[model samples]
Target chain A: MIDHIDSKIIALLGKDARMPNNKIAKAINVSEGTVRNRIAKLLKKNIINISLIRNVNQMDNPGIAFVGLDVEASLKDKIAMQLSKMPEVRFVSSLMGRHDLMAFVLADNATELSHILYQKIASLEGVQFTESSIGLKYFKYDYKWGRLLSEAK
Target chain B: MKNNLDNLDIQILDLLEEDGRASAKSIALKLGITEVTASKRISKIIKGDHCKVVAIADFEKCGFEFLLPMGIRVHGKQLEQVAEKISSLDAVYSVSAVSGIQDLEILCATKTLDETVELLDVTLPAIKGIKSITPAISSKVYKFQTDWAPLGND
Candidate 1:
């Protein structure tokens, strides 16, 4: 379990992935080296990933979509591997609901979305059916692992 | 190259990355710094435009059932026009004009499959200077990390 100080560090990092260790230490009233050590440990454990997230809409030809896919049980791994090969597919997962798989893909426009679905997705052997839903707006996106991380100062 | 940021800079970035609305005072309190210093640093970074802090939604809980990623190839210099039209669509979540032959990247989440197909078939093709499209049906999202590393994560 993350200790009190560690939790504070996590909360701060979640808010700003770019926070320096000195500030983290100062914020938590720990030594700068102590903060550094803790962060190293966290990274080694794969508890945190610090990276950039660009807003796709701000770009030139942005396209975003959500898809639910049903695949044959026998071809689950094969289909997933193939889907993962595509650059357009960023994230993929198996769900516990009506659809067996859920995914996020990036594209330039509607025409690109169609070609991928009709040609790429449909052409796959195990893909029995595919359904897509386009995102209109993002009301909230809390990647802070809010469930696991506490908000206490 | 952008010089590596210092401690104060990282602290400010961390606070905003989690919640863009966090005040400099709050960040200062958390970081044991004067509010004035925090505010100044934040102002400087925003002016630089390294990144932006904005509000994002959880579409799944918001009742968006269909979400798919699309790749669009453009004809001529029609990137700007096609992007505007696609963004105006009710289903777009995020759009990316990538560096490549394909040109644009789009993310969409909608209420139904029919809407997804209609937008792809009817709305997108109508945009002139369009060439080809590729759709990657996302089956799962294992992880998403928006915040880039400070000098310390490494």
Candidate 2:
């Protein structure tokens, strides 16, 4: 369970992951040791991750597509596992709705996107049909999950 | 926007991707470069707006039990307007304009089934010019890689 201090620390880190412990301590009015220990605890619990994320908009000719799959009921989980293993598949999730599974694929260009959608994913045994949406522009990709941390029980 | 990054920049990014807190001195030693160069490159990458070094919370662990991917078909010229509105919602993590049947795709995080239903049934429909919505709840998330550029380049 995350307390007030933990949420405060998380909010600061969400803005600048590289902010020094001393700086965070100053900002949050906590000791450097406290902040350090809290961050360590958070990491150990897999509650948060501190890492570098590339801005997709900065890349040249980057192709990002979301492919929704209708699959054989019995093979949904098996097929999702296979999609997860593909290098180009960045996000694979088993869904409950019109599509049994949804996979987000990232590639170099449109040609590669087509290949992944048609040749690779479509050929999977359980995939009955696929509907893909190529992301033309990214309006927002906010990773500041800190504000919502307070809502966590 | 095209990346003007050289080999060294990519290497530094790769190291940072593994550990965002990896010190400039440690990165320099690992890549056989001067500490000043590593530090400068790190500043350049970040200050230049190439990428961000940030903490990403796993939604499930952070009390968000539902990850809903909703596809919205907008009414004619309201695509941009609708996308902007959806992006403003606190629950929305991402909103992107796409090609094909849907005009916009959004990934939303909610805490319960009731909230998920409210979002799909009540909240979204209340917004004007939304032609239709197709919603899906992710039962399990297998992979969600944040470092796409480095991984794709390699």
- On TM-score, the leading prediction is 2
Model 2 alpha-carbon miss at residue A23, Å = 0.9
Off by over 4 Å in 2: A144-153, B1-3, B32-34, B149-154
Residue-level lDDT tens digits of model 1 in A74-118 = 887777767766767755656544466656667777789778867
- Residue B119's lDDT within candidate 2 is 90
Best-fitting candidate, measured by lDDT?
A: 2
Q: A76-108 in candidate 2: lDDT tens per residue?
A: 888988897898898888888858889899988
Q: B107-134 in candidate 1: lDDT tens per residue?
A: 6676677887887788778878778876
In terms of docking quality, model 1 is: incorrect
Docking class of 2: medium
Off by over 4 Å in 1: A145-153, B1-154
